[model samples]
Target: MAACVTQQNPDPSFTLSLSAVDGNLTLVQGEKKNITLHIERHGGFSEAVSLSLEKKGGGGLPSGVSYGFDPSVASGSNSTLSLEVSSGAPVGSYDLQIKGSASSKTQYAYLSLTVQEKPQPGSFSLTVNPSSRSLELPTSGSVTTTTEVGIVRNNFTDAVSLSLESSDGSALPAGISASFSPASSTADKSTLTLSVASTVQANTYSLRVKGTAGGTSKYAPFTLTLTAPPSPPPSGPANATLLRSYQWLQSSPEGDQPAVEAMFYRPRQFKSGVNIPDEEGHGSIDDAGAYQGWDVLTPPNGGKHGSVWQYSKPVFIRLTLNRDARLAVVWRADPSKVPNWLKNNWSEQGSVRIAGSDRRVFVKNFSAGQTVELGSVYDPGASISQNLETYWVLFGEKDGTPSPAPAQLGSPAAEPNKPCPQWVHDQYTTEVTMPNGSKRVLATWHPQVDPVYWCYFGHDHGSDPSLFKAGYKPAFGYIQDDLHTSGVLPEGHPGFKNYVWERDGYRWLFVHHFGTGAIGRVCRQFHSLQVAVANKSTGEIVADLHINTDFGPSTDNNTDLPLDATCPPEVPTPSQVANQSNGERKLHVYDGTQGSLNGYEPWRSDVPGNILGLNLGGLTFDTVNPITACKDPGCSSLMRIGTSTGETRLFAVATDPNGPALSIDASKAAATGEFYTDIYGKKLLSPSDPGAVRQYIKPGLRLEVRNERNTECFARDAFFMFYEGCALAADVPQAFMNIEGALSDKN
Candidate 1:
């Protein structure tokens, strides 16, 4: 403990009183002023206290403010202060802290001081050049653009101080101006030109030069840039005018679709007057006439198959060239059989390869943030009767109920009361397939169901269209076709969306895809019915997934299916089909609700032979949160793990009692190996290592580790990474984890 020392009353509002009579504080700026500090002693007083003045919150010296003591300011008490005004200090008011150190103890005190400005001694001036003007340069020549910067100083007493600096480094002419003529700010009046040199370019340019007022000096920077004219493009094969593939956006109720109609044939590259058509499309095209629908083309009599018309817009190229340069136009029907054929080959009065790929215009609708320019290509060709009905293009963003505008039957009018009248309605029919040979005959507002709804159509995961492989493909597959319409809702098309196709036939499609890692191999005849789903490594069924579920012609048409699957007597009404399962969820053979209720269509595809479909007979998604730990009242399987063809994939789950996760396994060569997922989202298994306790695995990360024989071979198969889920699963980095010693023998 030390003895205490004291001074004037300790109230922050007033300056402390000092007892030392001679000790005084001074305020300094341009002039110094005397300040009277009261001195008052209180209890616990000790030896004489020393005094020193400092900036309110700093040392005795603060830029322009410093303390001057009578006896001289020191670190301890009893010292005097003499305030000195710094010459470089700016005019302003400032707080001065007065510190008193009594013996070894000290306290803080403060006072206010202000500095007044004094007029500077010397005078300075400045002058600018060519206020503003324009300069022109040759389109393809080297030109230097410059701005003349001038700094002038007239009235002066002290050597008018100045410096020449620039905002940017533009080329400047040498000693632009001298004392008498040219100007230089640092010493005397001077002028310099800032310049930008042009290469073989054609563009406008801007440049700015700065001139400083020399008297006291302040930074004044001007900013600008000079650009040379834009140069003409260089000539070369790479720079040559290449034919840009044309695009047409033909949509169904959903969006753009593919089409081929009576576009009068004309040589593609005719730079001269109206290019002539190679062959006029049949005049009855709009009437559903001709090969490649040439007969159905608009104004069938307007021109022949090869009529010529000048058009900057690209017309459809109905002809497709195969690897052998064989021009083909192919068309097909579910025919309920797989085959190797073409549309324009082997004829019987007329009939080429069955379901051959069709050569048509590529129509695409796009959103911003993505390239809108794209060209159509020769996917595949298909053969059809002299009269295959073509479809029209529709845009996705437009709003309106889709009007059924099937091509009007041309020459061959429909027979009275015919199921598919030749001229009655433009709608087409597709097959309602079942395991048995039984098929449901269908009629749709969209004639091109397969092509419109099933084909791959959209901006894809891939970046380049050229990377897409060309081939004949079946239209997208939907589980049920009741009230499903692209115009109403977006159904999952295998390619991207559900398109419209006119048919009792199959549309040969070519996919321009830069397919990546694994893809599920789709196949037909699962239970002898066409099916699609993830497959196991052994090429057997592993999942039963589906596109969308639709009710028969909606309330509008009411063209009921034999049975209403989407809205069955067994199930509840539409209002009851909430996220939860209501009514009796009796897994009926038809799910009770057979009528279409306009629902979603899922996307499923196999490389070649595996079917991608859902188990209409067995649908379950736990909407009441099956797992106590999940925190969600949804199906048990938070993640779906399934096999398709030779691999497994992952699928995000929805919160529905009828959907948890699809089960799959490709273990058998004969068995469809398809199964539903177990309702258990989180799995807690014992850790193999003593260092670890419980093992928590995400449902997605879990794989089929063993086959029926309990062999580990199937789970570790590396080829199965192509499964959709594999790409999304994260690889865990773990340490010190041990495995069962007993299994070591198998190694």
Candidate 2:
């Protein structure tokens, strides 16, 4: 007995082996065929795994054979491939290299794919970061990620030099290099603080950083971040240059009544009108008198723009007491129709709304002497203890007075008695200690609600193009996987989330809010992980793509794409699929059945076997049947069927986290939480058999393809064959829990 050392280890182990596989190569010029392959784990505690392949020496796998992985295939089951040749493929047998191992293993092996040549897509990364500010630019050798001012290079074309083209079409300082920040930073980060000479066109401009890496160079992403924001000259009623643009609200166009503007506090007299602090917030306005809550300042029902009282020109609403004689203007809300007699200058656009994602220059104007608060409330993701962490910033007059910036939201006078949490990281944030000795946290920022940052980006990844591939994580919440099929994958279903880390391994992609899906291309370095989404409110991924980031436990979370160019399409290997008829028996199998609502069929004649075979090397899936007590209605539109082994797979529509499985419908899947078990004994996906082959077999615990007599129809020709899902090879090592060898790989 090969005392499988890792067979019982808490961590993962690997064993690589390759073998040539075949099924059918029905392809056209520029098209590829998907073939079936198998994989086995020498030792590891994990019962499930995902396998992938890469045509190592880069020319790419043979154009004739497009491959994919399917867990439907037992450890030694078959997955299919498509064969498509390009106009200039070096016809004949070429070695199609493949790589993969069990999800439970830390090792991987190489396999060979044979076929004719054709054009294939490759992948690469170009990243840049660091963005630290120095008093001056360094005068020295090329700046690489290893040092400050990291040089972002073309991950594909390591030889290519970066090109900096500003949005304003201006040139950059010579010798200034661009590169991806170390795993410590993201390419979207400010890598270099460019201070152009006044003589350089000082305008915000579009920027595009280009260069070559690997063997070839193609147009990369248009550097999306703005390089420079326009420096709007300071504006305030105190400055004579700006004072001329105003007309005091207390004074009529015909004359003036200074007393109206001096009810509680006296108003300042500027040359042109009155000098209210543009730097002052409503907080600065004296509130010592009546109108404490602006209760006494409501305008008549009808004001200008349909309000009674409106600002003719200048109306400074301060937050705090601005001066010894000041009347704090809290609301200044216009109610009814304004005196048509008054000429108002403020437009609806001039008013500011404090929603979120408002970190913009426009904020400056609306906030000049605007009502403000001291600090911001940490809209805790939920009403949970230790969830709220309020913070404040430094804003207001430069008088050096002890005042919280903009506004002091919570008891500013007692702020000294309170302290901020230890984890607070704002530069201006502080902690407050109460007399009771309990520590409190107070931090803040002019928050931009739900800021979007990319962890990884790639073009054209999803089965459809509109689906943009993106990976993301929320700043303050856990990602919710709720896509119908995506959210509830059965044990035997072939889906992304269905793939799991072997026992003890805690590894899985955390997608936050990528909207489109996966499509498009940008330069790479698989920089910090990021995801694209449609809307912050919706929280949907655009698409799933091959994204890389500096996370996990190694290299401080830095990850580069594994591509010199867009390497050829990867062909995945076959994996194990379990069958739980009479006993809980498991076996490895291959499956690739990319399906569409149009191709969904419950029978073999409706579709041909292998026709729906997954392109494991590329994008593929299995139509695993659910083994549950679900009460949900089936969608004829999304009805997916499996070419099970004639009749030994469970048909569960629901499951119970603690109770036995139930054979129900969709409606009950989530509501009941029941686990549907299979009493039939059917083997995992295998070639079709005839006659009594399936007589003794029972359905599987999962509703995936079972191997038996009736399965023969789907053996060689089926519209689509469903199987269990496979795991990502890159996410493997991170899945290790305690294996020394597995941990060593990460280190």
Candidate 3:
């Protein structure tokens, strides 16, 4: 191979080189410097290089001198190194060896480090109070003056010596002297007094305050401005003083009770002759051309009215306080100084302290329901018309009710403490049938409590077993059998309806609530339905069972649509008629028809039916039955007539598509002579066509006529309740109907 060496030179191999960027460096105790090391690949070396440090002669690193690399192992020959020196490090020079190794090849570099002991009081700062000032001097010559200043030490723990000199080339203002109270201090606060003499030039200057502590020094900068004094503000009538006055009336919005409290403000305090507002404020009308703005309250009896109690009258007092000083303006209403009328109406013995500091005021006992005035007379020199600030509080009751006591103000009247008579807590028991054909006695009711009709009105679960124990389940959520036995509807049936129905003998009572629930439980309602077989046929009647307990929003803003989302859309209104024809007329009164077109009527469960009409005598018969049967179509009831006379008229009714109901048919039928019915079932006058009212009678309920045209209806039974329009009205606890023989077969 040695002989063959001439044939080919050994192939070039890759090698790595290491070097120190800042190899030679100097450091002090507690101080450190960064020394970089560079690595290079001479040929094609691409392997990662690892770095470490050691003393040059092969011992461990110097005590307190630590070294580290951001990445101990550098990829592709590159990484940063960090070095630190502790304050306790020995003061000496040392050389460290940095070795970088890659692939079995290693290279070395040197780092020179020197340390020194840490210096005392290494950091310090200074600050001076009243950092700047402006002095006023005469134009001809300077004036002597003195101002108190302060010096503060910051971040300097050791004692500090202070000295002052002109920072700018002003030479301490020619005879101006500056000194600190104690001259030297480690304290945070010290007084600095600066004095300037006459004959010094008026100029702005900055002062340099020096502080030396523990062999270290710092400087604090302060500024001063000196100028000729401004000519005394053109002495005159002290800038037309303006004092505004205010008046507030505390009164109830409805009843005679006055407002419990009223607040007002005083004229804003001014700095001597500065910050004077050119215009009046605090409701002053002084500058307005007409009796407008704050000046409207300027008159002595301006706000007095028959129903108003005057508390104070607007007046202005012209007074002066020593220049550069503040004084109090006390406002007291002495009964001895008030007018007789004011003392009799209001508490004229009260006092209000303005504090004369802040411009705010508050008054209590305003509900005394009386008006007040400041006093009978104004200050000797004060004017009631100009440049005066006036203020007053008045209490009054416009509602005509007597004034409430001061202690009872702002609260409702206490209710009488009479115990409820005819009231007793007692138990009630009844037998009920269960779903499994078992009978049980229910004794959940109070015994001898005040007799009250128990009625459930909203969409809440019913506690009675008949409501849910059969096969029906709640739609909202799982409900316990015991909890569901008390409400009128399942816990969440959605809609607005009140009704009970009997089909094939089985009776079902249902009610719907729209957006109804306890506080925080309000939610949109849901739709529900059920079906079952019914066989019994004995005639039964259901009386007033559900009463209106909740009123909807006073306005129509909250009117919701059909209770069940599956219901049809609303329809247009039907045509009105002056007279009914012999032929059957359509009622157009169902939920999806024109007669119930309004948003409110579409959800009414009480008025849904395909009603037909017929006219007899002066009365019209609008019924769910086209023929003479009241069973097929439910609400076969009589029409209620208005107070109008002679003329016959017909009005359409609101209806729902879910069931059947009745309305009215206005048509002039038989022209036979007058006929009337007494409170009894007897008829007066010649017998006329019974078809007129027969078709409109609601089975057992009857319409008794007082005149020939059935213009008025008389209440005969104890439970008399009917809808006067859409609103329900009750005349007695019971109701009865008188049906003529002719209408007997119509039921």
Best by TM-score: 1
Tell me, by lDDT, which candidate is best.
Answer: 3
Off-target runs (Cα >4 Å) in candidate 3 are 1-343, 353-747
Q: Write the per-residue lDDT of candidate 3 for residues 1-747, one digit (tens) a residue.
A: 000000111111222223322454445566555545666554245677788888864579999998787678876545566778897999766767676666645555555565544444545555443345556555453344333323233344677777777775345767567777677876655667776665566566877667777786566556565653332323432221111112322222221221111221212221111111111212211111110111011222222222332333332221211111111222222223433323343422323222112222222232221232333234333333323333343221223111111111112321111111221111234454332335555332220111121111111121122221233221222111221233423333222222222333343333323221111111111222111112225323221111111111111112222111111122111111112112112221123333332111111212111121111112111111111111111112222111111011111222333322222222221111122221111222222422111111222321111122212221111111111111111211111111100111111
**Cα-based lDDT at residue 233, candidate 3:** 29
Cα RMSD (angstroms) for every candidate in the order listed: 33.1, 32.6, 34.6
Per TM-score, what order, best first? 1, 2, 3
Model 3 lDDT at residue 435: 28
Please report, in order, the local distance difference test score of every candidate based on alpha carbons.
0.25, 0.22, 0.31
Q: Sort by lDDT, best first: what order?
A: 3, 1, 2
lDDT tens digits, residues 1-747, model 2?
A: 000000112122323332312311212234444544544333333344455544543345653344456553334433433334565555443333344334312232333222222223442333222111112112322222221222222232234444555434466444433443332233322243333332333122345444444554322222221112222323432121110011112222322211111111111211011111210111112111211111112111111111112233233122322222112212222223222211132112122111111111011112233343211111113121221111111122233111111212233221110222222113223354322344444332111110011001111011111111123222211111112224231111111121111111112122211111111011111111212223223433221211222111101001111111221123111111011111111111112223221111110000011111111111111112211110111111111222111111111111223333211122322111111111111122221322101111111211112222112111100101111222222111111011111111101
- Report RMSD for candidate 3: 34.6
lDDT of 2 at 314: 30
On TM-score, who's better, 1 or 2?
1
